[model samples]
Target: MTDAVDPPAERLLHDLGITEPGEIDVEVIACAVGAVVRYRRLGVGDARIVGLGDRAIITVDNRASRVRQRFSVAHELGHWHHHRGRRLICHGAADQQVGVAGCEREADGYAADLLMPRFMLEPLVAGVPMSFDLVYQTAAAFGVSAMAAALRLADVHPAAFALVVEEADGRRWFRRSASLNPRWFVRSAASGVSVTADRYGLSRANATFAAPAQRWFLGQGAKDAQAFQTIDVMVCGRAIHLIVVA
Candidate 1:
C-alpha cells in the first residue's frame, strides 16, 4: 500500500498563520508539531530526527552556522510531519540533490518551502534583477543561507535562471528556474572546471560577467549560442554560480 501523504509546506505554513516573507522561527514551529529541539555536536551532518513515543526529538549540530541550524531544524520537523516512525539523519547541502534519495529530497523540499514560501518569495523577487546582490538581500530577509536563497530564486523566478553549486572536490549539482527549457543540461569540463572554478582560482568571492552559453551548457546549437550573464558567489567555501539566460 502507498504511504499516506502529508500536506504540502505551503498549506502547513498557511495553517500556522505564516503569510509573510521574513525569518521563520522553526523552533516555534517544531513545538507546534510536538517535536522537541535540542543541540548536540553531530558528526559532519546538520541534524537527525528520532521518534520517541508519539513525539520526536530533533538534535541539531551545534557547530554548524546559524542559517544551517535553522534549515536543519526545519528539515527534522519535515520528518516529524511526513515520515513519522522513521529515524532520519540529514546532511545539509551535501546530500540535497534532485534524486539521490527519496526521503531526503522530500524533506529538503519541505524545508525549502517552509523556509521560503513561494507565495511570499514570488512577490519579493518580482522585477528584481537576477544577481548575487538580490540573493544576499533575500537570504538576509528570509534568514536562510545565500545558497538556499539562490536555489529558491531559481525555483520561482519567472525568468530563465539557473544555479550551479560546486563543492571543493569537484562534485556539482544544479537547478533551473521554471521558464528554462528542460532540454538544457549543464556541462562539466574534463577536469571538472567551470566558470565558478575559474573565479575561485582568482580568489574572487563575488563577480558578474558575460560568457557564451556554451561555457555552461552542452550541445548548444548556433541558435542557442548567445551570451549569458553569470553571477558567482562563494558561500561557506562552496561556489554558487547563477546564470541568467536571455
Candidate 2:
C-alpha cells in the first residue's frame, strides 16, 4: 500500500458521531482503495471549484471566519471522497441558477450527506412532528448548523415540504421536492423578489397552506391545498418561506 486515507481522514464522520456513515463508508472505502493509485492532492482557496492533476482544489473568502473555511474543507472532502477521479475546483457558493449542474448546490448536497447521513437523520426525524422548533431541535442533535438542519428537513420532509432562505432580511433560497407544488411568486411576480415582504412577515412555522390565490402562505382551500401539504419554517431565527403541498 503506497498510501491510504491517513486513518483520521475517515474519522470526520465519527467525530460528527455518525456511526454507520452510510454511503460515506463506501466513499471512505473508495478513497482508501484509490488513494494508493489515485494520487490525490488537496488545497483550499476562495476560488471557483476546479480539478487539477489528481487533486481537488477549493477557494474560500479570507475575510470570512472558520465556519466557511470548515464548510469548504468538508466540501473539498466531498469532492475527494465521492468524486475523486475528477480534479475538483470550487469558488464556493455563488448566485445559484435554479437548475442542475450547480457546483455549489452539489457541494451543499454532499456536505449534507456527509455531516447528516441518512443513517443518523432518518431515524431521528421520522414522525418527529413537523415544526420549525422540531426541525431545529433535530438539527441540534446532529450538531449541524440551523440552516443545514433546515435544508435537511426541507429535503427530507415526509409529506410535502419546501424551504426558503432569506438574505438581507428576505428569502433568497427556495427548495421544493416532487411532493410540493408552489408558484411562490403569485404575489411578487418579479423574477427575483426579496422574500421579506410584509406578505411573509405574518407567516409562522408549522403554518399550513391551502390558500386559493396566495402562493407564499397556506391557502384554506381543500382541493388546491390537497395537491400538497405545505408548511412554514424559519432558519437562523429568520423567517423561512416554506410550502408543503399534497
Candidate 3:
C-alpha cells in the first residue's frame, strides 16, 4: 500500500503552516518549493515541468478546469520535488489508471497528499458513511474533482470499500480503501448494478443500493452477498461505483 502520509509534502504543508483545505494553495506551495507556475496553451498534454538545480518552471494548460489546473500544478510540483533536474509531460486524465509508471504514480500520490492532506480529510470522513454525497461534499470542500476526491477518500476513509471506475469502452480500474482486506478482489461487473449507460444512454447515479457480494466480490458465498452495498455515479463518459461492506 502507498503510505497515506507523504513525508515530504506533509512536512512542506506543516512548514508552511497549512492546517485546512482552503490553505492548500498549489501556486504558493510551488513557489515555496522554488518552482514558478505558469499557464500556457498546450497542444499535447495537460502539464509539464522543467527543472535545473532548485529552481523550476511548471507549465499547465490554461484551458483545463480550475480544479484540474490546480491538480496539474500540484502534480508538477511532485515531479519537481522528487525528480528535479528532469523534464516530464503528464496527461489530464487524473483518475484513469492504476498501472501508470512508478514516477507518475509517485507524483499522483504526492498530488493527492498535497491537495487533500490526511490531517484535514481524515477528520471529515471519519465515522461517516461512504456515499456519493459525501464524496461530492469533500470535492466541493477541497476544490478537487469528484474522481480525485473519491480516490483520496478511499485512501483515508476508515472503511472496507472499493472504488471502481469503468470506462465507456468497458476498461476498468479500482482503488481500495485502506481497511479493505487484500484477499477480497473486485469483479469486472455486478450484473443488476448498471455502472455504465445502457441502450437508452441511461445510467444509475447518486444513490446507494444493494448488490450481491458474489457479483462484486470474487469467490463469495450466497450467504455473504447480502452484506454488500453499492453507490454509483457517472462522470465524463465513465462510471464510478463505490462498493461497501455493510
Candidate 4:
C-alpha cells in the first residue's frame, strides 16, 4: 500500500492555526511563506510559481472561478513548500488535459490536504451517508468545489468508494479509497459515454442513481456484485462521478 501524503500539509495548517472547516485564505498563506501573489489574465495556464532565492511570486489567472483560483493558489504554495527553487505552470479545470506529472499530482494532493484538512474532514464525513448532496455540502463547508470535495472524500471516506473525473473527449482520472480492493479496475466506454453521461447531457447538472457494478467495473467480482450508487455532477464540461459500493 502507498503512504498518504497529507501529514505535511496538515502540519502546515496546524502551524497556520487553521483547525476547522472554514475558508482557507491561500493568499495569506502565500504571503506568510514569503511569496507575492499577483492575479493576471493568463492565456496559457491557470497559475504558476516563479522562485527567487528565499522568495517567490505566484501568478493566478483572474478568469477562473473563485474556488479554482483558491485551489491554484494552494497548489503553487505546495510547490513552494515541497519543491523550492523550481518553477511550475498549472492548467486549470477549463483545460482538461489527461495525464499529470508526478510533481503536479503531488502538489495537487498537498493542496487538497491544505484546503480540506483531514482532521476536520474526517469527523464531518464520519457516519454520513454518501451522496452528491453530501459532497456539495462538504464543498460548501470547506469553501471548495464539489469535484474537489468529492476527490477528498474518496481519499478519506471509510467506505469503499471511487471518484472518477471524466472529460468530454474520453480521457479520465480516478481515485479510490484504501478500503477498495487493489485489483478492482473501473470500466469506461470507448466513447466516454455512459448512463451517467446520458443524465449529464439531459440535465447538464445534478443527477444521482444506482446501477450494476459492472457498468463501471469489468472484473468478475464487479460483474456478479450488487449495484452501486452513482452520483454525478457536471463541472466546466467535465462529468464527475461518485460511486459508492453497496
Compute each candidate's TM-score over C-alphas.
0.84, 0.56, 0.89, 0.85
Give the runs in model 2 whose Cα sits over 4 Å from its true position. 1-17, 20-70, 83-88, 93-100, 169-173, 181-223, 226-238
Residue 57 of model 1 has an lDDT of 81
Off by over 4 Å in 1: 1-7, 87-99, 190-205, 219-225
Candidate number achieving the greatest TM-score relative to the actual structure: 3
CA shift of 46, model 3, Å: 0.5
- For residue 111, model 1's alpha carbon misses the true position, in angstroms, by 0.2
- lDDT for model 3, on a 0 to 1 scale? 0.77
Which ten contiguous residues of candidate 4 have the minimum total lDDT?
89-98
Per-residue lDDT of candidate 2, residues 1-246 (tens digit): 113342333355555444753334433433443321121232444333445455434444555444344444455555555565654455553222234365556665666666566556667767775556766675556555556666676655564655555555443556654345443332222224333434555444455545333344343442344322233433335455554444
- What TM-score quantifies how close candidate 1 is to the native fold? 0.84
> Which model scores highest in lDDT?
3
Query: Which regions of candidate 4 deviate over 4 angstroms?
Result: 1-6, 87-98, 190-208
- How accurate locally, in lDDT, is each candidate? 0.72, 0.48, 0.77, 0.73
In candidate 3, stretches whose alpha carbon ends up further than 4 angstroms from where it belongs are 1-6, 87-89, 191-195, 199-203, 219-228
Sort by lDDT, top down from the best: 3, 4, 1, 2
Clashing pairs in 4: none
